[model samples]
Structure formats: structure tokens, C-alpha cells
Target: MKVGFATQDLKRVDAHFGWAKNIAVYEVTPEGHSFVEAFVFAGDLQEDGNEDKLQPKLDAIKDCAILYVAAIGGSGAARVVAQNIHPMKVNQPEEISGLLDKLQDVLKGSPPPWLRKVMGKGQERKFEFEEEV
Candidate 1:
């Protein structure tokens, strides 16, 4: 699954969803993770209630299964959830690589129900039925 990190330095999930200057994306699997791409933003990125700043960021992470951020506004979180993306808020700044590692570890184990749901999004569902003999 794909994961997004809101960062200013691109090395940590240390920025708010609306104020982040860089949004880095990575492909994370139980085996490992790899960097996919990044979205860079410029100009004013303050908490001024400007909803327009969110569209590009949302579009950037549209395919991501989860997003890690230091903080996110209520509206931003709502929008993210509406898009079927899980937004995770960190109490403090965290290393992006470390977060990825933890996610990989969780994938190797039995992820929680919410995580499983997020991971299963866009995947084909299989069902088996028995015919009367």
C-alpha cells in the first residue's frame, strides 16, 4: 500500500497537513518500503483557514492508503476520510523512515481492523459459493 508523509524536511513527519511544504509518498509492504514521489509546495502555508491549499495535497496523496502528519485540521481530516484515506496524527515529530519501518512490522503481523480495511481498499474481493449437488 502507499503511504504519505507531511514534512518540511522530507525526512520526518513533522508538518501539518495544510502547512507542509513537502508531501512524500512511499510504497510500503511487509517486505520493505520504497520512495515513490514527492509534492512540493510554495507560498503562504499558514493556518488561515484557506481550504484551497488542501486540494493539491489531497490530489498528491489520493492513492495513498494512509497519511502521517504532525497535525491536521478538522476539515482536512474529514476530506481525507471521505477519500478513503486514513490520516494518522503524531503527538510529536517522527522520522519518516522509522514510521515506515513500524508500518512494515505491523504488516508483517496482524494489523488492526481499521488498518486491514485501509489496506484492502481498491483490492479485488473474492468469494466462494457452493452449488447444490
Candidate 2:
């Protein structure tokens, strides 16, 4: 399954879903995982009144089974869930590599029901970042 990490520095998952400028995606499996791509935020930073700001981010990561972030606004989380994308909240910034390692271990073993569901849906087609709006 493909997992997306909200990160500002590429080395760690330290950004909120609404504020992350870059998101790292990876194809994860029990045996291993590899970096798939990074979705760069194209929308404006000042999102004060633009409720639609989450659209682009959603479009970019539509293929991901889940998203890891430091935080997510209630509405944004709703939108993600509405799209069938699972949102995971991390209490603190975490190293992307370490996180992936732990996830791989889970993948190697028997994953919980929700995770199994996400893995099952991971085969969906992905939208090209540049081609899509």
C-alpha cells in the first residue's frame, strides 16, 4: 500500500495536513518499501477563507491508503475520510525512516482490520501530479 507522510524537511513527518508543503509517498510491503513520489503543495499559503485549499492536496494524494501528519483540522479530516483516505495523527514529529520501519514490521505480521482494508484498497489507480489539477 502507498502511504503519505506530511513533512517539511523530507527527513521527518513534522507538518500538519493543512500546512504541509511537501508530502512523501512510499510503496510499503512486508518485505520492503520504496519512495514512490513527493507531492508538492501548489495552493496559496494564506488559506484563511479558502475552504477549497484542501482540494489540491487531496487530489495529489488520492492514491494513498493513509496519510500521516502532525495535525489535521476537523473539516480537512472529514474531507479525507469522505474520499476513503484514512488519516493518522502523530503526537510529535517523527523520523520518516523510523516510522516506515515500524510500519513494515506491522505489514510483515498480521495487520488490524482497518489496516487490512487500507492495504486491500491500495491497488487503485494514481493520478499524475502534473497532469491533474
Candidate 3:
């Protein structure tokens, strides 16, 4: 799956989803992860409710399964969720590489239900008790 990180310096997930100067994308798997691409934005990106700026950012991560950010607005999060992209918020700046490693570890282990859903394996299972005789 693809993952995106919102960062000002492209080193950490330290920027708001709306104001991030750069969005670094990576291809992640249980084996490992690697950088895929990055999207750069300029001009005013402050929190002023300018929804237009979000389009390009959305386009950048259209194929991403997850996004990491320091913060995100309600509308921004809604838009991301509408696109089937999961947004993760961090309380403070976190290294993108560290996050990737952790995600890889999770992929190696038993990921949570939501994560499995994001990984495109969310099919509902019917247990024996639920099967109609």
C-alpha cells in the first residue's frame, strides 16, 4: 500500500494536512518500504478555510492508503475519508522513516481491523455459528 506524510522539511510528519509544504509518498509492504514521490506546494497555506488548496494535495495522495500529519481540519479529514484514505494525526513531529518502520512492523504482524480494511482485505467473514443450517 501507499502511505503519505505531511511535512514542511520532508523529513518528519510535522505539518498540518492543509498547510504542509511537501507531501512525501512511499510504497510500503510487510517486507519493506521505499520512497515513491513527493508533492510540493507554495504560497499561503495557513489555516484560513481555503478549501481550494486541498485539491492538489488530495490529488497527490489519491492512491495512498494512509496519511500522517500533525493536524487536520474537519473538512480536510472528511475529504480524505471520502476518498477512502485514512488520515493519522500525531501529537508532535515524528520521523517519516520511523513511521514507515513501525508500519512495516505492523504489516509483518497482525494489523488491526481498520488497517486490514485499508489494505483492501476487509471482506466480512461468516463463522460456523452464523451459517444458516
Best by lDDT: 1
Clashing pairs in 1: none
The residue-by-residue lDDT of candidate 1 on 1-133, one tens digit each, is 9999999999999999999999999999999999999999998999578999999999999999999999999999999999999999999999999999999999999999999999987788777999999
Error of 1 at 57 (Å): 0.3
Q: Considering summed lDDT, which 10 consecutive residues are worst modelled in model 3?
A: 121-130
Q: Please provide, for model 2 over 1-133, each residue's C-alpha lDDT reduced to its tens digit, 9 standing for 90 to 100.
A: 8899989898899998888889899988999989999988765744755777788888878988889999988988998888788999999999999999999999999999999888877465665766666
Per residue, candidate 3 scores C-alpha lDDT tens digits across 1-133 of 9999999999999999999999999999999999999899998999578999999999999999999999999999999999889999999999999999999999999999999888872335555666678
Model 3 residue 116 lDDT score: 87
The true-versus-predicted C-alpha distance at residue 64 of model 1, in Å, is 0.4
Is 1 or 2 the stronger prediction by TM-score? 1
By TM-score rank, best first, the candidates go 1, 3, 2
lDDT of each: 0.95, 0.87, 0.93
All candidates in order of lDDT, best leading: 1, 3, 2
Model 3 error, position 21 (Å): 0.2
